[model samples]
Target: MPLPKESHYTLADVLSWEEPDRVELIDGAPVMMAPPSRAHQEILTELTRQLANYLEGKQCRVYPAPFAVRLFERPGDRPEDVRTLVEPDISVVCDRDKLDEVGCKGAPDLIIEILSPSSLRHDRLTKYNLYQRAGVREYWIVDPSARSIQSFVLESGHYTAKDLGTPGDVLKVHVLDGCFIDLSKVFPEAGV
Candidate 1:
């Protein structure tokens, strides 16, 4: 389907509405996502724990899903011209000013989206373009079924992906300098 006209609901209108289980405004359309499966939630939790552990007391702050990060319209655009609004499975924010009671009001430093059977295309394609256009430094798509993590680093307005499948692979996020994740521990029961 084609995108809606940019005259859709404004952020204030969206915020004033009753919250849904998982509602996001993407390119002027409200995309309702189903609740993630047990496995998806498990992986997200584990990843959040690891990120928190690594970023503890550091300048960067990590957040779990249901945290909306809004991509505001440009200077000449209307308030209703929200480029995208998504709640990533996990996100990191190094900038303090963006943090708010509702959620991060701007692009996050890093976004981690765990793939589910129902959201494969959105996670890999729709969201991929959205984050890249918003200038997100890094984005990760973790596929539990494949037991793999695909890390994408935004370089000059595009994203370059790195596929880390096995436990032996050193999981490194380019934007998170010096941060290292041991894939072995991330997917300990990969063969199962």
Candidate 2:
């Protein structure tokens, strides 16, 4: 189901709300998040595990949602005035300055989102444009049902290259050197 968007809200509004359902603010609109499916969780786990292992003892860190990411926030931006907030299924932040108690205050080095039926369009197009505009360096969209991944790497502030791969392939994280995710482990049941 597409998330309901009845009223406009800001970072301050989101921070103040105590609702149970997780949501993301897109240009001041709230997008309700649905729970992940078993397959989605499985892929997310393997991907997060791989990224975490590679990041251990390193400066960069990986976080799985519900980690808030204020992608467009800049210096002196007020919470009530600033609007965009996102929760990538996986977020990798190399800049420690952006880290805060509220979550990441700026665009993460890399972001990964595992697709669900209700969120397929939102993730593929809406979030895709948002992340690209926010200057997220690398973004990956994983289709759990399809057992495939579509990757976009930013070049010259635009996503210039696209990499599509299946469960048997290996994907290198451009933001993290010497780091890779084994696709087979991400969706072990794909080839069976």
Quick one: best lDDT, which candidate?
A: 2
Give the distance in Å from residue 140's predicted Cα in candidate 1 to where it truly belongs.
0.7
lDDT of each: 0.79, 0.87
For model 1, how does the per-residue alpha-carbon lDDT over 1-192 read when each residue is reduced to its tens digit?
232344555565566566444667886667778898988887888788888998998999999988988855444544456646788999899988888786777789999999888899999999998999888899998988888898888887898876565556778878787887777677776455
- Of the candidates shown, which would achieve the greatest TM-score relative to the real structure? 2
Query: What are the candidates' C-alpha RMSDs?
Result: 3.8, 2.6
Error of 1 at 67 (Å): 0.2
Tens-place lDDT per residue, model 2, 1-192, is 333455788888777666546888899988888888877887888999999999999999999989999999998888997788899999999999999998999899999999999898999999999999999999999998788898899998888667787878998888888988899888786345
At residue 31, candidate 2 shows an lDDT of 85
| Residue 55 in model 2: lDDT | 92
What's the C-alpha lDDT at position 104 in model 2? 94
Task: Provide the TM-score for each candidate, comma-separated.
Answer: 0.86, 0.93
Local lDDT at 131 for model 1: 90
Ten-residue segment with the worst summed lDDT in candidate 1? Answer: 1-10
